[model samples]
Target: MPKNIYFIALCLLCIWGCRESASKAGANKKDSINKVVQDAAHEIAGNFSDQRSLRFSANRLDSFFTRYDSLRTFQKDLTTFYTERNYAFAWYSDSGLTEQASHLYVRLENLPEEGLNLVLPYKHTLDSLINAANTQTLEQKSETELLLTSLYFFFAQRVWAGLEESATQKIDWLMPRKKLSYSALLDSVLKQGNTANVKEPVYRQYNLLKEYLKKYKAIPASSTTISLPGNKPIRPGDTSPEIVKLRKKLFLLGDLTNAGDTSSDTYDSTLLTAVKRFQRRHGLSEDGIAGAGLIRELNIPVPQLIEKIMVNMERNRWLPTDVRGRYLAVNIPEFVLHAYYDDSLLWNMNVVVGKDVNKTVIFAGSISQVVFSPYWNVPASILKKEILPGIQKNPNYLEKNHMEWNGPDVRQKPGPWNSLGQVKFLFPNSHSIYLHDTPSKSLFQESKRAFSHGCIRVANPKFLAQYILRDDAAWTTDRINKAMASGKEQYVAVKDPIPVYITYFTAWVDRQGDLNFREDIYKRDAQLSSLLMKR
Candidate 1:
């Protein structure tokens, strides 16, 4: 052959060789996928048929459900799921179990990272069934099939939909719990496999936090606290050996895009910026100080943070599916009130929630009236605990506090000196908890702001009032201010009731997709965390 002809022949040979190798790789990949199903069927050796099929009907499901009573509540739903397919085999085939079943098995086994404590479906029997060590009779196959379906329901209920309403109520989480159709979900998952929205019902925050959970899990737990000698704050410009450690810590947390120069031990502006980012994310003062509080926050194990993330994910499950209309959401732990219109967040502001003694109840209500120059009705407990003492000290306590007796109960006159400030947004509930302006505006500046008697004290009361009254042509800013200044009690009913949801969440992802960890000011996280880690 000529030189050009020889070169052409060599190229063709090389191309053919590459094609042959690619074909082999493709076959290997397919085999591996099928192997997952094959291995599972092999484990659960049975008097199996050549064609994979279900041995039981919907009527037989009840008998099998007796073995997994926890799944009794979902028996009807599970039956519908299996019945949809005329009770055909879902997991297995003549060759082996289907790949979707294999996917579900892996997903169920990894529920721990999702923070589930329940025993898995077919815990011991699964191993023997998959490996063919234990022969599965027709009846046994039917039982195992129903059991796996029960576990799927369990996963959806516990991980995605959350615990029963009674359980959530026991924890005092009273927001309208999101309702999910597990029957529909089961049907979708079985038909579509991994493409189904298994994690769809969950809040976006759950998925966002899961990313951080994986990253945090990769980080080693810090047993020792990042202590500073004399327990002093590490102010900006201070040179401490801890600066290097802090840089790496912040970097791991994604506060610092780059760790910057760690060679120099000085607390430079670069690291200070990172420290401020960390502080801001955690709802702390951005004072550029690595103080004892910051050190304590830093020392919290990544695993603990991951648990917090998971705990909050479960809480999100309790939230409603749609919050599109105008409403107010106050996160007690974050000490912030988020205002939404048409499901879009308009803005958020600092709020003073109830202390541990008088926790701000987590529930939903409607803001029906904006009470301008409203009287502060003293609760019986406060009267005995705080007011009775005041009157005991001063004979003119009622006059001094601008309070007057209204029947048996006393109320403070609305003014700048009033506890309820210029205005109060009323959301009629048994708890009598509502959002109101406070005379003490300075408290809003504090990083930790939980000093209320079961109600929320909004920092930007005027702004909140403006937002609430924007739709009503009758209430202009000037007229609203006049009403507030009149110091005479007045009530204006809202034509459109705005829903108010007071929630308690210690951890949530922010608008910027950054994870935010707020201090559990009401000390609720400990109890909830204990409940979650019960396994």
Candidate 2:
């Protein structure tokens, strides 16, 4: 043979060898894909067929099927699995099957069997992919297996996060350092294999939940009460310096007679003063006489007052967290209104709250607007029941009281006799109530002034109007006085809206931290106290 002929032969032989090697490589890859598909099918079948091993196998099979199409030559098996109900050769392979098998193993690790139920509907596609993978190349099979594994791990993490969030409850007040014994609880919950293990991280996430349960469970359902000390009487001729000092502390200067000596009066000034002071403190008229009301006030022990304050503080905590920053704080027991700004008391004054039958509600809202010399839109209950009856008895009742009837509405003309005082600070409430100046100035003189239909009665209307109008260029003390003096009904618009919160608090700590107690006119404290005990 010639040299050219020999060279041509060698080239042909090299080409043939490369083609043969390529063919072998392709077969090995197909074999690997087939094996993965077979293993995945077995998992699916075992999951659905065997009761004990069903859950784990199903999850493993679902994970494998999700990535089945990514395997080379596995696409045919995947399609067939969905089209046909074959399971045995679903994941069959010719060569390199062990590499793809490793990927499937990793995918099944740490995933609970309970999660497999979510994947049962796609069993056919999983079966098909397993059966078709037998013809895939080695490289294709390895890539498909790795891709499936990655997807399984990603989905598993999501499942775990969701389960943790559901099982763990966030508690706001639990201390962070406290430890919880949740291992037993976890064991109980996991007996059916429906949930994951209560891992160390899970315990950390649920610490707050555990702490709250413990705290709530430990709280006693009843409150303990203590009795007050009985009152001691002061006698004449027994004028010790201490008794005289005590008498002076209890009584007003006017109530004291023959201050230096204890022997000169028909009624002992010291005893009378003590009685007056006691009466004043207990929402009774500060009369020197030890009347029924005065005696009652003196009998209430100091400790009971402290208990009332503590209970009200707890009630305050029950209020919504976002209470208005600048709002009216009406101490019902103190019969006072303290305007609060930035959580500090700006100014305070004595106030007349609603009557016992028409007690003020405990609620929160904004003072949307202020109505100057506003009309008292009397409540329906008061209108039909009280005013209507009075009008019937005396047809001239409206004219005499400077009240005009406009259909069902009754308007009070601006004057001393008007039910609403000279200037009313209007903070509209849903309960059809407002904080306004009252014409019944004498009511403010009473020690316990719970006489309103429902509105708050202010003692000094001019002062409140001045405070509110300070920011307005158009409103001033002079402007307000002119409006009221005009004698015709006028409305002064507030430049800025102030929030008003009409709350019923019988107990609270004063600016001095001195615990103050108000009379439980509505008896809400008693009810709440009972509830606290039950808790």
| lDDT values, one for every candidate | 0.78, 0.50
Error of 2 at 449 (Å): 0.9
Please give, for residues 1-535, the per-residue lDDT of candidate 1 as tens digits.
6554555566556556666565677987656545754554443332133322544666787676676675687788777776665677666565556555667777777876675656775677755565561466776666666666777777788878876788778888877878888877765675454623454677667777777777777777863346785778887788877767777778778887864564556888888888998998998899888888889899888877877877787787777765677888888988999988765788999999898898999999999999999999999999999998999999899999899999999999888899999999998999889999998999999999889888999988888888888899988999988998899999999988889888888887788888899877766676677776673
TM-score for candidate 2, residues paired by index: 0.48
Tens-digit lDDT string for candidate 2 (345-398): 788888998887887765555554555656665667867897789899999987
TM-score of each: 0.83, 0.48
- Which pairs of residues have clashing backbones in candidate 1? 42-132, 43-129, 43-130, 43-131, 43-132, 44-129, 44-130, 44-132, 45-132, 324-343
Worst 10 residues of 2 by lDDT: 167-176
Superposed Cα deviation of residue 132, candidate 2 (Å): 60
